[model samples]
Target: MLHATGSLLTIDVGDRSVTTTDIDDELAAFIGGRGVATKLAHDRIPFDADPLGADNRLYFASGPLQQSNMSFTGRMSLTGLSPLTDGLLSSNAGGYLSRNFVATGHSVVEIVGESDELLAIHVTDEGVEFEPVPELEDAGVPAVTDAMNDRHGLESEHLVTIGPAGERVVRFASVMTYDERAFGRGGLGAVMGAKSVKCISFDGDSAPALELPNEDLHMEVHREAATSDDIMRRQGTTNLTEFLNDEFSLPTRYYSELEFEGAADIGGNAVEEKKYEKAACSVCAFACKLPTRDEETGLETEGPEFETVFSFGSNCGVDDVVDVMKSNELCDRYGMDTISCGVTVAAYLAANDEFGNAELVHDLVEQIAFREGDGDLLAEGVARIHDELGVENWAIKGLEHAAHDGRVVQGQGLSYAVANRGGDHMYSTTMIPEYHGKIDPEGTAGKAEHVIRNENLNALRDSGIICQFGVGRAVEDDRFERLFDADFQDLLSVGSRVVELERHFNNQRGFDGEDDWVPYDLPDLESSLQEYYDERGWNDDGTVPADRVDAIAGSD
Candidate 1:
């Protein structure tokens, strides 16, 4: 019955045979949710697997703590090889859809083969079925969500649907799982589109039995995070703009300059002052989700988080919060990855002289959504845009323009450059330790050591499916281990260390230590890696010391 953990369901439309199995001991420890799914994808799919081909597998996984009283726990991961990065891609979303795993009594859904017809996979506590989604074709998330509610006759049922962005197979397209919180990032949505799977809906009244070390201890941990100065009590990550723009002065604009004078206009206080509503995920108490209603677009949506605000607001030279909100809504509706989508649009605008024309911008967005004209080129992503448009001024790796100066961030920048998925911020945000405040923001000295540490820590977080916000304070210290019990600690540490080995895995795929080098265009790009390697105790190559690798591998 798949009671304690979730079930893994594999459906082959080509063979018309469905196999369902319980998430077992080996799979649970291998990658947990996100990490484990990546392991499976790497093993199952060939390096030459066409991202949108029938041979690829679309992975959807729910964590163990999903439906419990755990805070901010409604997260599901969709992982596959991305056509954008042409490497591993894993995106996560938060909404009621995660709760459905607990209700429907399953952990992961693995679907294979191409369906000639449009279909939505529906799962209930009773069982699973694939139904045609004629009404949801080319529809955005909100519209599809409404249609699902009407069909199921239950508002509680969560819907994971993609918009035209996904259906069009935009290289940076995302799957909008929850209405607002997306399985966003990477080209996971486009992978689903290639399979002709429109969406997946499920709901049920069920909760798994949680295995807690101690009831009192568990509640105590929650109390600290819920009331801590870092997460709930502070202004939240929304306040990051003020620190980056005003204090650190590291906000990037079209990859030309860092520092935005107009940042104050869109600061966290501005959001709270101008907007009066807030939203949160399924069981989360800390709703950092700031929903603003724009008069121009006549739409209301959650977030414009620090990344979105920076990428779309200041980075693109648009200062109005309302304008940023509209852009945010448009990206969400189109099922586009906000980070990549915004950066790709900005790249085009910066490259094309016609970008100044308001009409051209409108046409570009429309065409990209509908897959016509220059939108075809624009939908491919910044790297592709650089190749097609011959603009080398700026490009992205994980989905973001190189932030904090690609060189100054050291191997962190290396990870960004060669990340299997593309330019990403969260994959390696070691800026905290590597960057000394008020110093040369462009300096790359002593960054490799910090990058390795933070990357491992972040890997642990993703594998554990915990929010970075809750662990922000502990990110630089050992307190990070306090969040989990002893039993899970061994797996977390091993998994964290394994991330680098996987980086080596990419190295075996033709990328190298030289590939870790930042583009020489940035001011400090040349010296960053050398200085970073020196500080990290590496002998020139960015590889970790074998002794340390063995020590970590032998842990627990």
Candidate 2:
């Protein structure tokens, strides 16, 4: 795979067609890889089309720094309307897929339509194919991964597939990539299910020649990763649990309480003690994926990352780390979102007073995994659960049933409500600024700016298809701009413009100030909207300033 030819390819699963587009040096220089992909996705899909219909498109795009020697840069973004939140959703994952996708001379793979039958798209240097995968019809994530690895030879192919959760259209189902990595938010897996796409198996032998702006800049970011305060390389991401639990007491159980007694038991240290081997993403220097077996269940699991740890451990009142790992493994195998599954399960317990009925809850878990009985109700998310159970105060009360409790992380609460995807954390992560004291998560005043900025920047990052951890690991502020060939500020300004464009796109879909506030359940929750707005020069409403929107969306 030579840089002289366009390595990026797009495949239309609906029509079984392949197309390759040249990467304009200008767009290539500014947006880089993932950013460009976001622009393309926004431009391609019709605004009013059903997200799950054949008209919707899923763009799995890689970034310019993907195959390069940047630390934790091997990531790709899955962009589309999330079936979970019903809003713009994009989540990144680390694995060999991004590297393979790019190495094969393809930057993007576009999937379209609700396929009439069960199928998997195999992308290779020889082109692409929509092949049958009836053998894995009801298999779970782990089984599906093993079957694909066995059939394709694990070392040669990279795969992304949906487990039974996706097959059953769980609203929060995630799209699992590689073996352990996942685009694990906003029900993108359900979108894949709606399209009848069982899996994506990618193979390529063409090696990419990824050179940075200057080898010096690449070396600098690489060196920083090795010695800097970045947590992934220094302590692995599992350490985030310690930070979140110790700093904010953020592990809410079924939206009722903020603290968990077992936080330390599920921390990074616990993972090291229990897991077997550690692995890294493609081209990544840090080996953070802790592949381990639970001492009690003897179940081999990949991670109990901060999100998973909180989502299943503290959030579900399941204190035992081994139980959390087993539960995590179960969710992944079943192709369900750990956060939503755990939260939904917790909500169910709270709703039915079954929080005390371990046997009933266990049966429900199995049912949800298989989409049977009450499992069907659980599959729709907390909102639906609240409706079905008819318990207003006991369930996840937001639109998509993402994280619990709108009262605690007010910024997150606003994001859950306004996000087109039901309830989600990633669509716009305001936690970073709030946690840093740059904005107030407890006040709703400046939230509009906080939410919009994070959403835009994260969208660009997600679109790059690189791991979100990479943004913290390699690229941050002006330092990250060095990864691109363009000037640092210029590259970021381009990202700002892309952000505004996304806002405009959302506006077309009827997103407004009303969609920018916290859910009704959180009577005390507020955000830094006022302060954030003052800083960004916006009105109290959080709408993009007319001048700002004009500057970004100029008369084109």
Candidate 3:
């Protein structure tokens, strides 16, 4: 195993004890990050454990590429039972954290049990320390990062933290790192908050010596990133805003409409006008992160990315881009997933007929973080409270939908129905091909195979700890096999195993083919789903067979 540290670190927050064990088998078999983390979670997390309970564990892990510090390798993976979906889930974030994490010399770290008081855990090559942090209870993300830097001399890159939203156990709360980057989709932060954990910081210098297939490959990719004139570098992800809105679906007014009249005001060009600086992750030269500021109002933040444009801008009928930026800042400051928080707020606007009330939208973000007034119900996420609000439930499996309008992008619609993470665009990522005209976007007849391959490939990418934006750029073609020290098909197989592990784990906890669903209808959905199951060799009920489950069980 090229990047194997040959060890695992298990932390029991309750007892403040640490155990390190050999996990070379897992490292080699799963290829670390999402794959290894999923393998561990499938075996260890109790099937019936509450998502926010002490029994639920969160796994933070790294992959081989971290050692290279390559252009797209500055990311890491995390897996756990989801507070939002009540099923197993995994998320990854890109930042300066992965290199620091790999420095601790453990490829995988498992956080389990709960603490009686709010706490922070520090992991280093020397050892682990649990510090009771009662004074930091319910602190916001900025406050925690400042205290960690001021009191402990730990920088933003060294900390993984949750804000007031997580401590309040908001189902859509996010786990943040590098100050702004997030393990964002699932409510992993709520799980941390449920454990009474405030933050965990990493620092060390005992990184393993990685064997690269081609030493110059990273620099080659870095040069490509540095010189590329990708439009995303100019506007970040919001570059897709006006285009998706004009040609496809932007999910206006809580998905009641598909077009926004004011999209130009909040689209990529608008965001570009506010961008004052450039930012990148770790050694990555892509520098695609949006660092925007409104000098007139003295407001600044990282991004109101394309999704935020949909969620807070068009979805809630607010067209002013600055309002969306403020909403983005609040979500980051309070440690919440922007997609879930924005969509939940959009749902609120729909139910109350308050669309376009930007002030109310900002209030909702803070309210959800603090669980105040109507924010409490909204904090439960759209799936849990849509009925009481007398509005259409736009979520699937408790997760609110992203900006990609599945009704227009049919393959993505199919992906949303069956994704383990539920309605998340990145889970299968059919949107890219659909946007590029690579796949027919009007039907699901022959889309199952493509969806399966994409899911598997993304699974491997998460394990690789590679940024998704770098897919076609830094790590495509035969380069993927070379970097991972494996064949193309074999890597896909590893990804398939990871996906099956998650599905099987969630299956045991009462999800099945029935749970593989979408809110809106799609053409030939039934046959496509059958094709998907048949391709994977799963049971008709959408459950992984015992033999396949056993094949991935344990490190052995």
Candidate 4:
């Protein structure tokens, strides 16, 4: 088994108290990261608890592989009840935070109860310290991160901070680390804001010894990733733009169309022209993160990733590459999810016929961060915009849809409809097969099975908290089995159980077959959902049988 400190750090902001607990058998059975975090949320958070209330708990969890020699294991999972979705929410990000957080001898950090005053929580090997950071009030993410690092010294600390958008409790606010990386969905940042937390900094130096079955195999994986022909390494995630546009799956003009006339202007090749440096998470060999700088505007930022490009560039009709990059930088600095920010802005632009107005987009981003004027409504996310204005807003389970235009790709549409985390594409990348032509995009035949299998595999990958880019190669090379020293079938079984647990969480909150729907009309949706339920052994009503839940939990 992997070695860890196996400790849980609990911070009660309301009482200004801290406590620690040993990881117990029940939590251990679920492994770590997303798995253990979900169990904690299920046990501690009431199904009906206000997502932004003191009663709602926020968890930052590191996976078992974190802090190990494994490549792409530097990612972390953040979980809580989402103000946006009103159900379970788990967002993952990659950076130095996970490695240092795990090194602090705590696998999980759970925060509860709101503070009366704004505070910053600092974690070290000595213990947790809560300090008031009133000066950070209404600060942007980059400024907050910089101020904290300057105060604590950058070499020794990693910081996660919320920007003014989060300070205002905007529903889709993001928590950012390393200036650019984010726990970028589901309004978890609003949860932190509700607790009056400005930032979290970790400066622990303790490193747990990892027991690897084959160190040589671990090295081999890293070596392969460094020399691999993976597209991620070559052009980052923006490489998807050309392919998505070619397949007519790119979201353009707020999902009004699938293809953009200016798609090539903001695609991978365009991003390369502005690329200044390539960055990576701790020990990750892919180095997929491209930090770019605009020569004309002197704007510097890390990404306008595939999703960001779709959200701001095509979706909002702002096709200028530099403008999209600037918008992405604004979202990062302001601590707002680019997907939500871009989509919300797209909704406004579409209603107003202000497409391609870069100046208006910039002004709106600032307004939303500060909750100024109409930006207040926009900051609430696309669902609220749809409710208030009766615009053509598309979302699944309250959260805004990702970059992919589901209308063009039926399997992707189905994935969005049934995804536990609303319209998130990362839940299960069903579009992979369709993109490669292994499956027909329009055909619904066997799509449910494809999604189910992908979800289970994705659950496994998320539990390890591995970067999705490394997943295919990892599985093909049997890296997971060798790293965990467990059978592949057993690992897959655990992953299936995790997926069921997530479904069970949603089911308890009264989600049913009706709730699983694409915002746009799909003729074959009913049949597809029925097939999905049948394939997963769920009831036709989309509820897992009680026995099935028990069986999955019992398997743990």
Candidate 5:
């Protein structure tokens, strides 16, 4: 409430209209970022709306902390009905966009309606403009970005654009920002494509004024981050590759084998070896981004992060980190989620026994973007095309599984099954505790409690618009109290409400206990899963209770 502008912007591309409304009560009740976005999507979007139709709205929002100079606050949240999963999902992207978005004088921006022509919508303090650019049809991310820069002097930081993948409505297309950073899950870019909105630019001088309670904490965190020697700052998230492989959960050769003998070839050390310079988003320190280049091969990309490494490297049987790096770049340019795109390629390899064919992997990345030939079938994603391809379904609710195999980390498998976002590891992050041996990774009992707490805590972090690495991860419970000027539990309550609201929305769409499923096995799966629902005070099924929904929406 302190940082919120208490306003929402709605842009209807179909009619070329821009409107604003006061959301004072909603902001107070839901907080900002994911929380506010979820509430808005719940109440406004029709329960049976098609994920890629005009009825499905995209909400882009930043949270209270974005008003401060906090080290981990340089991220934004995008909430929408997922084309891949057919459920509500909130995806986070870290870049310079959050700062520019906050300057627009609105807590959230919603894009609605469909346009007859591909248009770029520009938002500023003064007003809005919809410019039709038919010539830019089928362009990739860089082309759209370069056009925006040349025509409007807007940089990648000021633009959120789609690529050929989105233009073709690839089921796992991604909404890309800062050229490379992505709202990588759930096909929101395809939603944009469906709406005929190719890009949106933000720059304004109407940022709301806010008072910081623990202003010094920002500097303290930044100073610590500047002096820290965290391995993530060197290799990005690839630091988890070898460990996951060692634990027999790396999902090599398309989930057939749990371990990758060549894990070290594409693990953190390999990524770090290609590092040419440091990179960070637009704010304070804690530069944990990997900007790598292979000078001999002339391949440069930000990262083939842990998930990317899993999907394109080990999962596809490719040992060369640079090959994964090229896949990473290809996905970014084409605006596809690397996890989904890589798995699509791997799924093909499974059918053809062509594992480790790096050239085919790269070619598949392009074909998926263009929706050509086999790419057209693979573009449909693993879940939808598995029967035709004659392979084991490796997807949950249509979203491809990430690197952390659920079988090895039993808790994570449970987390993946009941997750609202389907196969998204971040939904609960049970892997964190499992990885640290805080609990038995193989045990099923009592794991639900950890999943519950982590789901809420992560929801809170997304609302804070914070990263989950470096000092962001180290920021403790008490530190959060001073920063938000609110009780830690109270902040977590906001998260609980967000989670409940997501479940409520999905329930309205007919998802229940049956929909929360994983492909592989887990011990006591039904019992532990039911226990999770019981602890949440929901029915025996996974749907949120009617009373709880009212409470989450603040109607009670």
Candidate 6:
């Protein structure tokens, strides 16, 4: 029903051969991005397969909205079986990579097998080319992207690279774009490293013609976003630090406290002082990505986003904005998830409360990236660290928590507990309503219904692969019909079905009620969990009924 000219590109690294197949049925059933990619993971990866082994496949997928003129449609979804969680993982990043990917005339790119040597894959209009990149060994993400662009001529090409963390197979490695955007969770970069892939560069001039249902409405949304007084427009996501800190929802000292003492030093105002420039993804009207530079050190990098500020700053007991920027740059360059890296460091620093030691945080991030000294243990992520050190580490299903403190935000807590990807904030962000004052942040009553509805809505957004912030505001304004030509209710139904599919996949792989526990001991947690399960028609034991699953699947 959408476009069918694009094929699913499959590459076997072992033989260095490429194949293409039409995925019309898959496109119709699962849509694209997370849905289609998760379906591919379910079909191709064995439950018992080692995540880093040849049996596992990595899928980079773009949705139908990709390459459209619509705002916030530039995001891409990367799905794989996570080595950390040992479950289905999908991470999204905003950049030109998805646009370039769509331009290559492919809906999905699947890489299988493993390369015997360090290599890079270049995809162009003609075909795929695998080139050995031995020189890129032990390089950081920024360096690798620079090298790839230099080699290929950077005009229209975009690079997705892994750094030292991935090269060493750190369990929380991240896959990064050229400008430091990352598919930054669940150890996906390790999957690329396990396959011996240094980078994947995309270059093409073929863009599928996009015909929006209402071009005028699309323009209207863009006009509104461009001139809107949204905090995102003024200060980017970094604004969340101050707001969350004000609400006492910021995780500080490894969740030992709900608020940070030095919140003012690393918040929106502080970040604005060091802002070097503002950046945005392809066709995005809300240019929320800010690249900052420290005047003293002259170290410039893409972000120290709200998560970075909370994780590296407050969570690690550091308050210096420059220090957070340095840590963010190091994580970006080294190819590691900032949330996991920062939280892991916080666990090691739990004994000390002095906080805000820039030098100490920098050295610690370096050690983790290179696996030097205690970095080896931290590199294993929060779950394994908790097991080995007997520390009270905060994580759900092996993935580390985001910036939100579950002890305070009951709705976020419930969503975090049941999220398929484990401790993911974006999976079903109840924060939107909380932030907008539509819902009481401290209340637990009726939160389960709110979370369930938001979860279903978010599933549709992610499957459409739209930027969460942009589409989130659109959904709030009831503009889905204007932008996507789909009824909001229909989209929510699709989202509910996607949520069921994800839960089913996790269940088949042995996750149950026990795995749905939040890391924190909140008073209202038990009641909230019960409410969530009851609202979603799931059994009290956290199992979805087979008949319900069948009905949802049948509707699809």
Better of 4 and 5 by lDDT: 5
TM-score-based ranking, best first?
A: 3, 5, 4, 6, 1, 2
> Which regions of candidate 6 deviate over 4 angstroms?
1-5, 155-157, 351-354, 475-477, 545-556
What's the TM for model 3? 0.99
lDDT of residue 541 for candidate 6: 81
lDDT of 2: 0.65
lDDT (10s digit) by residue, model 1, range 155-175: 533777788988989987888
Candidate 1 accuracy as lDDT: 0.63
Q: Candidate 4, TM-score vs. the true structure?
A: 0.96
Give the winner by lDDT: 1 or 3.
3
TM-score, every prediction: 0.86, 0.85, 0.99, 0.96, 0.98, 0.95
Number of the top-ranking candidate, with TM-score as the measure: 3
In candidate 1, how many Å is residue 291 off?
1.0
Clashing pairs in 1: 6-107, 7-107, 31-36, 397-422, 397-423, 398-422, 398-423, 398-424, 399-423, 408-444
Candidate 2 wrongly placed segments (more than 4 Å)? 1-8, 23-26, 29-34, 154-157, 207-211, 224-235, 356-362, 391-424, 427-429, 436-453, 463-466, 470-474, 520-556
**Candidate 2 to truth, TM:** 0.85
Over 4 Å off, model 5: 1-3, 470-472
Worst 10 residues of 2 by lDDT: 393-402
Best by lDDT: 3
TM-score of 6: 0.95
How much lDDT does each candidate structure score? Answer: 0.63, 0.65, 0.89, 0.82, 0.88, 0.81
Residues 1-556, model 6: lDDT tens digits:
2322367899999899999988767766666788777777776788777889987888898887775666777788899989888888889998878788888888888999989999999988789998998988999877776776677775323888899999888999999885488899999999999999989887788865555566676677677767778888757888888778886578888887888889999988898888877778888787888888887889998778889999999988888898899999999989999999998888878745435666888898999999999899889988887867666858899899988766677678778888888888998898677767788777566788888888887777777767888765754535665555666676676677777766776777788888988876656777778888887788898877888867754533
